[model samples]
Target chain A: MVHSIDQYVDVVGAPVVEQLRRLGERLKDIRVVHVNSTREGGGVAEILYWMVPLMNDLGLKASWEVIHGDEGFFGVTKSIHNGLQGYPVQLKKKDWDHYEEINLKNREHLLPVLEEADIVVIHDPQPAALLQMIPNRRGIWIWRAHIDVSRPHHQVWKSLKQYVQDYDASIFSLTSFAQILPHEQFIIAPSIDPLSEKNMPLNKRYVNEIAKAYNLDRSRPLIVQISRFDRFKDPLGVIEAYRITRKVIPIQLVLAGGGATDDPEGKEILDEVYKAAGDDPDIHVLLLPPDAHRQINALQRLADIVIQKSIREGFGLTVTEGLWKGKPVIGGDVGGIRLQVISHYTGYLVNSPEGAAHRIRYLLHHRAKMREMGKTAKEFARENFLLTRQIREYLTLYLYLLKDRGRSVFV
Target chain B: MDMDTVPFYIKDCTLLIKMSGFSPAFDIRDLRERIAQCSPSVIYHHYFENLLAPTFDYPDFRNDFAVWVKRQLDDDVLAERLGMIEPYRFDSLEDLRTHTLDIIDERLSELHFITAVPPGHEFYFQEAITVVFETGHVMNNPGEMFKIMPQLTSSSIYYHFLEARRRTPDLTDDFSLWLENFGSEWEPLIRDLRSIDFIFYSLPELKEELLYIMQQYEVKE
Candidate 1:
């Protein structure tokens, strides 16, 4: 479903919505194009699903474009993705060539729209090579790196840096993820759509039905961690935490996620997670389809305590989603999780499975503190991690780049 | 009191923070060196622009340096000393930087070993690009503030009230400066605005404080 800026007025107040409209007016009719690898699945696609429509609603001419690739191309890009996340993967020259060749193939179809646009934002490494490909572009080009590339593999970063260095600007989700690029690098954290099926409020009946279908016992407390089955997400660690917690308290664990087309490593990780779960009835390792948003939403709503537990993360939108559903998140103390989960406030940040298990037990034992933290978590997500604030920052960046680069204040 | 014809053009701002290209500091000595070498904008952002950034609404300390000291280094005494340095009281950001380094130096002198955090907890230097724009809401008179106070976004509150201290010539809030044109009858409200200990309050808390003051004055009017 398409969303308008006005729909968010009830979630965020009228003043916030009105502020977006005013910012929108300043850049009315400016053509903005966003290019990424996949049109569905993953956080990038989910963000674009709401962002493009809302930008149009706010008066900017915005569009989203996706680059299609075969499995071999995706495999190569996945290696680059893993390597950028500090995983040791050697991407050869042929791998880099195949990556660019696929982008070059898509360049023919995308060049016209990309060249004439007022601003073109290339998301992640898949389409990052497109910048150097479109040499005659007449607009400000920005590369938005959504992953943690702070301690990337040297070979992969050196190759990727060449593709991104000439852009007018770059954007990272966190300051730590930024590299020593020659151009200006801005920090814009990703946010979730509160009105989307994934985060929108569901009726109690529907939530209960989802719970019943999943065979989750209503009597026992549930701990849900929803993320892609990647080693960085550490599904095995979540199970370990659950096992440790179950020894002290009876709780159910749901490790649910869907696969994206661009992520080639998910299947192997999923198999590993299933083996680690090992005949445990309470541990539900679900490989959900791409469109199972409401089911994910229901699972989060059913959770007494939400766990991300990612060893490495890119803003951890699942944590935001859980917090939006009024469940406190126990996230790993790495990457963007540190930004969202505050100890003794929203949720605790843990370094190990033992720490996570300890916090899970503590939260379950102290129901009142859990309720209070859940309340604070929801309001915290409302104030900081919603889509409106993200859009406002994007618009602000556009205004800053287009109008004046040196001025402290735009007006 | 006569109403001033000059309308207050209410504006709002959002900050787009970026890396200052400085290396992350893992220890107090490294932090002090970075503070001395980093640009003034970096100092200004950590000290002043932190309120508008995405963070906990009610942080224990007011600034990022102190928060890092308190949370990562686990040193309450140094955190308190660094937290007590008011950025607004300093004549310039350079002076603020100097005072910050002095506090760090004093703490370093007291410690037998350098206080260092673990790998992931290192302090990354950052700065922001603040984009300010007209909200298109104009206040015609001082009495209208009673109605407009609650409706203001936190960014609008920051732009007009807190950020105004640095921008205006007299180092006063935009509200107080605008109300000054209406004569001495609004002095009580101006005094009330001035009386706010803004250093400790977050944007939302500051907004609530402003709203409470406006509500009290509105009743009197």
Candidate 2:
């Protein structure tokens, strides 16, 4: 038999990792699989990538799979994403048929692997339709939704939920996202791995080198935020804030990020961002490749201040990444931003570019107080937002769902 | 038993005209209050007939007949809403049967409907609704509402007695004999109400039955 997840308590934390170890002692080698939309981008993908390995480290047979879709499929899914998030999307008959057809294709390739797994967790709208494919799966199929569906557009939500209802259980990121579906729902917010290369402390030399290479001046204060060039992330607004703060404390704004494989509208949004920043040398918009984690880490480290001025954010990982690096963050007051940036304590939650600019100027000018705030932010994240804590929450949910299946695997 | 169902009274207005012995070609179309001029019973009877009629004379009205019939007579608790609501709504009339069946395939969609709102609100309708906390709550049999709000004084026909006595020149000496004769006469038309295979041709006939119920409860002077 495999050893318990308690093997990870020292590496991660004692409370949850140790409990996982005890649970693992009893429920050893239980096969669990996760299926999600993208392999490289989005919070779900990033979390599952690290989570699967740690779960395996904890002695469970955990594996991960990513669903593949082409441009047409991605378009339909992006609309479905908006619909599920409460944006109005009028879906025609052909749209519904196209959604099922793509699911059928993915099923053709991925069906055999999913069916054999003990428990399959389908991630978001992309993999939700996989349930209709495996009618005879001997294991429990759980759906994991990580978007804000607190007030979803009815027509699309109802149509998409048609597929989700069949799963044995469902998991949501927040309480507001839970709908009146027949199955059970559990809340599991995402987390960042402290030990990962992206999060672990970086060398001062490397941070300085990246800043110099990116044409950044070390004499002036630095403000940075790393996110995709999408409307949801509000890259253009971030530029506006940098322009606003230039009047108070002259700091360079590094808008460093790139598009994911799943997003089709990235190029169009990128064009809009370029036009808005039009020939501004101080506004450094580095469209890095998808695998630019180390560059991102260095940018966060070099920054005297970090800001996530999003119009609407879906749990900004960049915010947590900044906080973990001991930088005071000024973020927008929406979605998971509220959860991350504790007002006047961890960082200030502002509404507009002017507001973000105001906070950025204040933080950049006050170096000593900013460092103290950064320390507070880091401790806040260490206590709450670590990957080990996230894994424990999930393990507990599994044991809870486990109670219905014949016998108690855990007390 | 009461001669009429509550839904039958609420819906059937046309047949009430014939029962009032008003001429069919009565050139009273110009009168503004003419439809309401007929007693509520006459309105109730016609509403039922139009609803139950297998074939409707007007094109806009054809889809209505089946739904109205199912409301009054279908024994299945979720009858009209199950099949009728999806088909007749604005978008689905394209391929008729196919489109209707596609929508009918859905077992549960959020039950979105209109409700009266308070005076100051600008919305023409409000989304005030609650999911039935109890199963079979919608299927209260024989036209009875499964639950009634005690604070509101308005009563229900299937659970509460009708209060008016029709001064029928043809009123029978005894109520039981009248009910038995009416039930027997209408047996051929009395849609097993349970095995409701066909829409009733006359929906307002229930108002005549309501007169039978009202005969039991005389309103005190």
Candidate 3:
């Protein structure tokens, strides 16, 4: 659903909307381009869905360009992603060669649009090397590394760092994930669109309908974990936690997530999740489509407890989504999840299935504590993790980078 | 890692004092006498001696090094110069001594280098060196010196404390004790750790991880 900045004025407040308008005035006529691996399925694409239009409405010539690549290209990028998140993945010489080869091919198709833009924001490792491939690129290029690189495998960081060190600046989700880059680094946590289809208020009737449609037993306290079926998301761990929690509390589990177009590892992980949930009637695994935003919203709203037990994460947008819906989230203690899920305040962070199950039982047993945490989670998300705050940071970065390079923001 | 031998020069004084507080095994008494004979104030004081255990004693090497120089050696100029020497900035005693000698080289010859090991206590020097250079004074040593030297090494205290934490992950009191005094590293890590990753580390494993970082950014006295 399309949303105007005015709609969020009441939700976020008049001050935030006014701030964006002022920033937009300084960024007027700026040709901003956001290039990433995919246009749908993933959080980056989902964010750009609203961010681009909002930027345009604010009077900037904002555009999003999706990069084209094949299975081999995505495979290499996925390995790079894993390596950046501190999982050791050895990229063979051909892996690096194949990555460069695909970007070079994409560069030919994207050069004209990329070079003409006043600012180009390349998201994650998939399109990081694009800057070097494009010729005479007349723009302030920023590499947005969306993975946790606090303890990156040395060889992998050595490879990725060379490609990104010369960019105008790098942006990470947290200060710990930041590297010793020559260029300045900024910490901008990813945000959820509070006014989007995935986050908008849904009626209890609609939520019940969606729950019935999914064959979920809402009578029992429902525990839902909504995320892509990725290994790093640790679908198995969530299942283990659910199984352990079910031993004491009569709770139902919903592992609902869709595969992103660019990610090739989804089916394998989905199958693993299926094997993990074998013959378990209490476990409801819903493989929703990319457009199942309302369903996701309803699931989050209906959930008694929301869990995102990712082993590694760039930033769990679903965690923010859960928090925004006033659900106390049990999230993995990694990446941007640490920034959102304040332990014992918003929700407890768990490391293992046993820990998750323990917290699950504690929260379920203590209804009042659960409700208090949920209330705090909602307010915390409102203050920090909303889309308007994200847009403000992006615009501010553009203005600062432009002014640093001797370009006048007023002009 | 580097070795050089220099001769001792005295300012016409034979008065010598023992440098105490190091492990009784280390020949610090002979070393201090050699140093004090040259100049009472120019004697080297180990950064560990002033540090209080269970509670970290802040490093005050400059003032302590100068007190000996001013009060004992009676050379105010040399005392002030020694006071100005920020030994805390150097990683090893060798580096600090070299830096100090360079500053006072025009005045003193080369004060004789004492190994700080007492007679018949050559084994303790080897043990101390092993702890300092090999295990970072936190691992594999069963000696009283190793147990007591964590505060002296600065980073070793954290390494040892983290090791204790790893051995008994459920011991909240031990973790709390470490957190109370040396929280600069643990608090940030704990605050930022994903809940799962926070529980993921066994105390020993966390120590090794912290030890790697401490090696890179060693806590100097």
Candidate 4:
């Protein structure tokens, strides 16, 4: 499943693909390593799945590495993750010690590759301590924070900042999500691979088969909110919206997501969602496996109006996936969701369940407006939120960091 | 047809935006104060970079400050005044900053209270690093450009047509500046390109307009 840069010529133009080749030419044979916590089941993993191959395709020597952690280690990292996203969690000295101990163990095998690489990008907090481990490394290190840390818990950030403070640079998904660090903070928004199983177009027969398997009635309209069962995603709020909308409009709601290996709080959140959705035939609360990408794609394609009711989000790739499938999305008015969903253009941004219900009913009633918004949404994703664009920016960043940091325009 | 004319080398750019290291502005008075002290790159980013940024709607106002004024402050009169100050019309970013502050200052004097937004709605200052590279496509003549124009990406169109004004000594697009070397025959097409009200159109729409003007000139020739 290796992807060539030329494969994207049809989606984006040849000039766009040619631009990537030229940028890739400038940094040919530079060893770039990306390290993260999980190898699958999250946005970071999905990005690396295509990024490593694409970077290699463009003639750069690129590789991806993952750090393995047990349940206790993951539990601590999950607390750190939640704490970074403005959640209040008490993390003691033992928690930080365990986090450092795991990274220290992984550093034994990774130091050889990491020390000699031209650039090493540490994704998220799981492997952030690796920078402090490699004291004499001969490369530019960048910390890519994929979550909102605008208002992080003081204790967590105070501890975590020590590990990331010495990096050459850092990247955040949004400006608001960035914290006041001592290095240059670049803002590069995350994008989805349109040709992946999660976002690629599916045939009507396959979509219908998925619908039939899930016992979803195709006659009525469906509102689907696909995300992990986390408190920040607000799965219960989506159920509340469904109940509010179901009173007048006959609709089915699907709240489906897969559990990432590093997430220890997902099971607890899923149990709460199940209890909230009790005795409701139309409300399908599915706990999918990590590899259920095609099924998730089918579910999104089956939906009339897609919803991503997140109280907080990294970049809301589910909202992008829904938009790519040509459906109007109703996202929460927070984080990256505000960037994607325009009130009257693509879809509505709601702050409460009542607001979500109102928009759902309005879009369902006006079919023509829904069609117009869907058309606009697809083209919007094509222009801005595609993986090709993200790759181009990353290549450009490499060139900037390697060549010259003072110049605003690089020729 | 002229042998002495230089070829047009097509180039494209992609923007990498970064925070300007300024604290977020919570109100109009704070915005004016920051505008007075912030760097020119920060001013240029808020005014010109919106065209390249990802947005769902065709915004009524062109710049981020005006949009914030309209949406957050809910003052269309002030928004209208701020949006009307075109960045490209100024000789320098310093002049643009002065003009921008004047409008805000005028409005401030007439207001009874300071206009402010809620915590989450504050305006954050940002700037961009534009990476420019040659696309390796060259046109020997305007006819060749006419043939290759539609095949170019929107970024290419932006680089040649809009962003050129910032870098070129003549403060005109690359196409028109290059056309000037071909003598008086290409004068009409150069005038058409220069006369385009490019501030209102999106990149795609702007490309269409460029193509339309080229097609009209092609038929005449």
Better of 1 and 2 by lDDT: 1
Residue-level lDDT of model 3, residues B1-221, one tens digit each, is 11121211100000111212222223334323333333211322232222211110122223444444553345466567666665434554566666555555544543465233222112111000001112222221112222332222222332333222423445322323333344365454333221223222332234444444444333331
> Which is the winner by DockQ between candidate 1 and candidate 3?
1
Give per-model TM-scores: 0.98, 0.63, 0.65, 0.98
Residue A284 of candidate 2: its Cα lDDT? 86
Against the unseen true structure, what C-alpha lDDT does each candidate score?
A: 0.91, 0.60, 0.67, 0.90
| Top candidate when judged by lDDT against the true structure | 1
The true-versus-predicted C-alpha distance at residue A153 of model 1, in Å, is: 1.1
Candidate 3 on A60-89: residue-level lDDT in tens?
998998888899899889888878877889
Report the CAPRI category for model 4. medium
Find the 10 residues in a row with the least total lDDT in model 3 chain B: B123-132
Weakest lDDT window of 10 consecutive positions for candidate 2 chain A: A402-411
Q: Per-residue lDDT of A341-370 in model 4, one digit per residue for the tens? A: 888889999999999999999999999999
Clash pairs detected, candidate 4: none
Each candidate's fnat, in order?
0.72, 0.00, 0.00, 0.70
Better of 2 and 4 by lDDT: 4
Task: DockQ for every model, please.
Answer: 0.71, 0.01, 0.01, 0.71
